[model samples]
Target chain A: MQPVIEVKDLCKTYQDGLKALDCITLDVHRGEILALLGPNGAGKTTLISIICGIVSPTSGSVTVDGRDIITDYRFTRQMIGLVPQELTLGTFDLVRNTVCFSRGLFGKRSNPAYVDDLLRDLSLLNKKDQEVRTLSGGMKRRVLIAKALAHEPRVLFLDEPTAGVDVELRKDMWDIVRRLRESGVTIILTTHYIEEAEEIADRVGVINRGRLLLVEEKHMLMRKLGKKRLTVQLKEPIARIPESLSSYDLDLAADGSEIILTYDIRSSRTRITALLQDIKNAGMTLKDLNTSQSSLEEIFVSLVKEEA
Target chain B: MNLEAVKVIYRFEMLRTWNTLMQSVASPVISTSLYFIVFGAAIGSRIQEIDGVSYGAFIVPGLIMLSLLTQSISNASFGIFFPRFTGTIYEVLSAPVSPFEIVLGYVGAAATKSLIIGLIILATAGLFVPLRVEHPLWMMVFLLLTCISFSLFGFIIGIWATNFEKLQLIPLLIITPLVFLGGSFYSISMLPPAWQTVTLFNPVVYLISGFRWSFYGISDVGVGVSVMMIVLFLSACLALVWWMFRTGYRLKQ
Candidate 1:
C-alpha cells in the first residue's frame, strides 16, 4: 500500500549554521504507529516539524498521500495533526473554545458534538469549561491533543507525548493512541522513553546525530539483532566448565554456582539438547535453568552507541 | 479564500476585545473624553477660530486620527505578538490557513476596532463642539483608509517585534510623535513657509489634513495627495507582509 506520509532525503539547516536534519528518508503507512526513538536534539522534533509545515526544509521533498507538502500545503496540512512537545496553549481561553477554534482554523464548519466527543475521548470533558491555566500538566497535554485532532485529520504526529507525564498519565496517553490507531488514523510519534515505543510502536526507527540509524519492525529487529542468554544453576559449586562443553561459548558465574551460555537466536541450530546431554555426561548436574532474550532497550542502546 | 479560517481568527480576536471590555472599549472612550476636556473645553476656550472653524471643532479630526493610529497599531500588534510570545502561534502557523487569510482576519479586526473608536470619538466630540462635515462621504473614506492603513502597519509591527519593548517602540516613540507634530492640533498654514515645507515631510500631516478637510473644507495638502499617500503606505505594508510570509521570516524556522 502507498504510504500515508512519504519523506525523501529531507534536510534542514538553520540560519545559524546548525544542521537540524540531514538526508532523512522515511515512510509512515496508514493506521500504523511508527515511533521515532532518539535522544534530545536528535532531530526528532525537527523532522516532525518539517512534515507538519512548522519549519521549512532546506532541501528535498515530502508528500502526504502523494501530494507535495509545499505545493499542496492546504490539502496536506488539513489531513495532518501535530501535537507538539511543548505545552503551548492560551491561558485564558476555555478548553472547548480552543479546540473549536482549531477546528475553525482548519476551515472546518462548527460541530459541537464532534468536539465534545473528542474532549470526552481525551478525558477532558469534565474540564471543558475550565480555563487552560487551571488544569494540571497532564490535562493541558490532553487539550493539545484535542486541538490537534479537532479537525479530524487522517494522520497524527505526536512529538514526545509523554515526556513529562506521570506513569499513569503516560499509560492513559498510550491507550488513547491505541484507540486512535484502531480508528484508522496513522500515527508517528517521537519519544525519549524506550518503553513507550516498545509498548505501543508497531515499528521503531532509531535516529542519532541527525541521521536515521535504522528503521525496522520492532519484533523483527529484536529477533535479528537481539541475543538470548541461558543460565544453568549448577547442582554443586563447579570449578569450571568441562572440556566436553568447550565448543559452546560459556562463562562461569563469579561464585562458580552458575554457568551462562550466550547464543545467537537466529542460528538454526541452538544445540541446546546436545549441551544438556553433555552436561549430564560430564556429571555437572543442573539445579535450575532459565533463558532471556535481548530487549528493545538494549537493541536501541547498541544502535545509538554504534552510530556515535 | 478560506473565509471560515479568516472568520475564526477574526472572531477569536473580537472575543478577546469583548472579554477585556474595560481595557479595549472603555479605556479609549474615557481617554478620548479626557482629551476633549483638556484640549477642547479647557484650551479651545482661550484660542480663536482658525480657517473659519472653532479651535475645538478643528482639532476633532486630528484627535480621532490620533486615537485611530495608535489604537490600530496597538490592537493588531498585540493581537499577533501575544500569540507568538505565548507560543500559541503554532496553531496559526501549522494550520491550513494562508498568509493572506491570516492577515485579513487580524487586520480586519484591528481596523474595525479603530473604526469603532474613531466613530465614538466623533460622537463624543459632538457634545463638546458644533460638528460639521463638508464632505461626509470623504470623511468616512479618510477615516476608513486611515484605520486600514494603520492597522496594516500595526500588523507589520507585530511580526517585526521580538520582545515587548520592540512591540511598544514604534507606537510610543515614532507614531505618537508623528501624529502630534503632524498638525493634529494646528494648521500647517499657521507656521512659517519653511517650517510648513518641513512639516509636509511628516506623513501623518497628510492623513490629519485630509480628515480635517472632510470636516471643515480646509487642508494643508490636497485631498488627492492625502489619498495617494495612504494608498502608497498601505501597498508598501502589504508587500512587506507578503514577503514576510513568503520567506517565513520569524514565523517558521
Candidate 2:
C-alpha cells in the first residue's frame, strides 16, 4: 500500500543555530497507527509540524500521497489534521461552533450530522453548547480531537495526545484512536510513554537527539530485543550455584534465597528441560518458580542507553 | 481564493467582536460622543466658526477619522494578536488557507468593525451638531479607503508584535499622537506658516484633510495629494504584509 505520508532527509535548524531535527526521514502507511517514541525535545513535534505545514523545513522534503508539501501545500494540507500538544482553543466559543468552524477552515461544507456523531463518540455531546473555557481539561482535549477530525482528514497527527491526561481519559483517547484507524484514517502520533506505543502502535519509531534510531513493527521489535528471566526459590538458602549448574548463566540472590537465569527468547534452544532435569538431579528442591519477559520500557531504556 | 475558508475566519473574528460588544462598539462610540460634547459644546462656544464652517462641524470629520484610525488599528491588531498569543494561530497556519485569504478575512473583518463604529460616530455627531457631507460620494470613498488602509496597517502591527506592550505601543505612542498632532481638533492651516509646512509632512494630515474636505469641500492640502498620500500608504502596507507572509516573519518558523 502507498504510504500516506513520506518524509525524506528532512532537517530543521532554528535561527539560534539550534538543530531541532537532523537528517530525519520517515513514512506513515495508510490506515496504520505509527507511534513516534522520543524523549522531550527529540524533534517529534518539529517533524510533525513540518509535515503539517506549520513550520518550514530548513532542508529536504515531505510529500503526502505523492504531492510535495511546499509546492502543493493547499492540497497536501487538506489531507492532514493536526492535534497540537498545546491546549489551544477559542475560549469563548461553544463546543459545537468550534468544531464546525474547524471543518469550514478546511473548506469542507458543513456536515452537522457527522460532527454530531463525532461529538457523541467522544462523549462530548452533553457539553456541545458549553463554552470551551468552561470544560474540564479532558473535555477540552476531546474538543481538540473533534476539531481535528471535523474535516474528515485522510491523515492525522496527534502530538503527544495523551500527555498529562488522566488514566480514564487516556484509555478513552486510545479507543478513539482505534476507532479512527478502523475508519481508515492514517495516524501518526508522538509520545514518550512506552506503554502508550506498546498498547496501540502497530509500528514504533524510536527517536533521540534529533535522530531516528529505528522504526519497526512493535511485536517484531519486542521479539528481537525481548529477554526472559526464570527465578527459582530454593527450599533452603544456598550460598552459591552448584558446580553442575556452571554451564548456565545464572545469578544468585545476595541473600541466597533464589536463583535467576536469564536467556534470549529468540534463541532456538531455550534448554529449559535440561536445566530442570539438572536442577532435580542436583538434589535442589525448588519451592517455586516464576518467569518474566522484558517489557518495551526496558527495551527502550537500553536502546537509548546504547545510543548515549 | 477559498471563500469558505475566508468566511470561516471572518465570521469567527466578527463573532469575537459581537461577544465583546461594549469594547468593540459602545466604548468607542461613547468616547467619540464625549469628544462632540467637550469640543463641540465647550470649545465650540468660544470659537464659533473656522474657514466659513462651524467649529463644531469642522472638527466632526477629524474626530471621526481619529476614532476610525485608532479603533481600526486596535481591532485588527488585537484580532490577530490574540490568536498568536493563545497559540491558536497554528490552526489557521496549518489549514489549507492561503496567506492572501488569511489577510482578507482578518483585515476585512477589522475594517467592517471600524466602519460600523465610524458610521455610528457620524450619526452620534449629527445629534450634537448639524453635520453635512458636501460630497456624499467622496465621504464614503474616504471612509472605506481609510478603514481598509488602517486595518491593513494594524494587521502588520499584529504580526510584528510579540507581546501585549508591543501590541499597544504603536497604536498609542505613534498613531494616536500622529492623529492628535495631525490636527484632529484644529486645522493645520491655522498654524504658523513654518509649523504648517512641517505639519504637512504628517501622513495623518492627508487622511484627516481629505476626510474633512468630503464634509466641507475644503482641505489643508489638495484633494489629489490627499488621495495620493493614502494610496501610497496603502500600497506600502500591502507590500509589507506580502513580505511578512512570504518570509514567514513571526507567523511561521
Candidate 3:
C-alpha cells in the first residue's frame, strides 16, 4: 500500500525572504511514529504547518491519503490533526463546550457520548463544566489534545508537545501518545529534546538549517553509526607507557586511572586481543573492563554540528 | 460564502456575543439615558425646534444610530481582536472553517448586538422623552442598515488592527468625531453652506440623516441620496473586508 502521507519535493519560502524548507522529500507510514528532530531555526514547525494547510508553500506539494493538500485542501485537512506548540484555547469556555465546538466545526453532528468518552479518556470528565482558565497547566495541555482529537483525524501532528511540561505531565502525554498509537493513529512529533525522539520514535529524521541531514529507522541508524568505547581499569596506576607497549596506541586518562580505546562497531578487528597482550607484556594488570555503545543523542549532536 | 459553513460560524459567533447580554443591554441603556438627560434637557433648552418637532424628539433617532454605530464597531472590532490577541484565532484558522465564514460570524454578531442595543436604547428613550414613530417600517429599515453598515466598517477595523490600542483607536478618533459632526445633535441646515458642503464629505451624515428622516419624515438631506450613499458605503466596506480575508492581510500574517 502507498504511504499515508507523501511529500514529493517540498520547498517553502516565505514572502519575507525566509527559506523555511529546502526540497524536503519524505513519506510517513500509517501507524508508525516519525520524530523530526532539529535545532531552533530548523524548519520542523514549517513542515507541519505546510502539511496542515496553515502556511502557503512556495513550491512543491504534499498529499494526504491520496488527496493533494493544495488542490484538495478541505478533504486533506479533515484527515489531519495538529497540536500546535502554542497553547491556544478559549479560556472563558467550559471544557466540554470547547471539545464539542471543535468537533462541530468540522461539520460533525453532536455526539454527546463521543465527547464524553473523549473527555473521560483524557481524564477531563471531572473538569468538564469548569472554565478552562481555572485549570492547571497539565490539564490545559490535555484539553488541547482533546480538542485536536475531537474530529478523530487519522494522522496527528504534535509540535513540541512537551516543551513547557514537567516530568509527570510529560509522562502523561507520552501515555496518551501510546494510547493514540494503539487506536491506529499515525503520529508525527517534532521536538528540541533528542531523548524524546530516541525514546518513542520508530524512525528519526534530523534536520538542521532547512535541510534534512538523515532519515532512518532507529535501530538501523544506530547500528550503522554506532561507536563503541572500551575502558580498562588498571590494577596499579601506570606512570607512563613502556617502550615495549608503544605499538598499542592507547591514551592513559588523566590521574593514570584507566585506558580508553575507540572503534567502529562493524569492524572485524577491534584490536582488543592485541591490546590485552601488549598490556600483559608491559606487566599492567587489568582490574575491570567493559564496552559501551553511543546513543542516538551523540549521533544527533554530531549530525547537527556537521550540518553547521 | 458557503452558507452551511457561514451558518455554523454565525451560530458560534452569535452565541458568543449573546453570551454577554448583560453588557450589551445594560451599558447602552445607561449611556443612552445619559444622552437623554444631558443632550435632550441641557442642549434642547438653548436650541428650539428647527424642523417642526421638539428638540428632545428630533435628536432621538440620531442618538439611537450613534449608539448603534459605536456599539457595533466595538462589538465587531473587539470580537475579532480578542481571538487574535488570545490566540484562539489560530484554532479557527486551522479548522476546516474558511475565512469568509469567520468574517460572516464576526460581522453578523456585531450587527446582532447593534440591532438589539438600538432597540433597547429606543425603548429606554420612550421612558424619558415620548417618541412618535411617523414611519415605523422605515425606522426599522434605517436601524438595520446602520447596524449592518457600521458592523462591516468595524469588521474592517478588526482586520487591520494589530493590538488592543489600535482596535480602540478607530472608534475613538474616527467614528466618534464623524458621529459628532454628522448632525446627530443638530441639523446640517443650521451650518453655513461651506460647512454644510464639507459635512457632505462625512459618510456618517447620510446614516444619521437617513435615520432622522425615518423618525420625522423630513431631513436636511434627501432620503434618496442618504439611502444611496449608505448602500454604497456598506458595499465598499464589505468589499474591503472580503479583500482582507481573501489576501489574509494582517490576519494570516
Residue A72, model 3: Cα distance from true site in angstroms: 1.8
Interface RMSD of each: 0.7, 0.7, 2.4
lDDT of 2 by residue, B1-253 (tens): 6788899889998999999998899999999888888889988879958888888888999999999999999989998999999998999999999899999999999999999999999999999999989999999989999999999999999999999999999988999889999988998878999999889889999999999999998898999999999999999999999999999999999
After superposition, the stretches of candidate 2 with alpha carbons farther than 4 Å from their true spots are: A242-249, A253-257, A266-282, A287-290
Best by DockQ: 2
| DockQ, all candidates in order | 0.85, 0.86, 0.46
Give the per-residue Cα lDDT of candidate 1 at A29. 86
Q: What's every prediction's RMSD, in angstroms?
A: 2.0, 1.7, 2.4
State the lDDT at A191 in candidate 1: 97
Docking class of 1: high
Worst 10 residues of 3 chain B by lDDT: B1-10
lDDT of 1 by residue, A1-308 (tens): 99999999999999999898889999888899999999899999999988988899999999999999999999999999999899999999999999999999998999999999999999999999999999999999999999999999999999999998999999999999999999999999999899999999999999888899889998998899898999989889888788898999999995898888888889988888888899899987789999999888888888888888
Q: What are the TM-scores, per candidate, against the unseen true structure? A: 0.96, 0.97, 0.93
Model 1 residue B196 lDDT score: 93
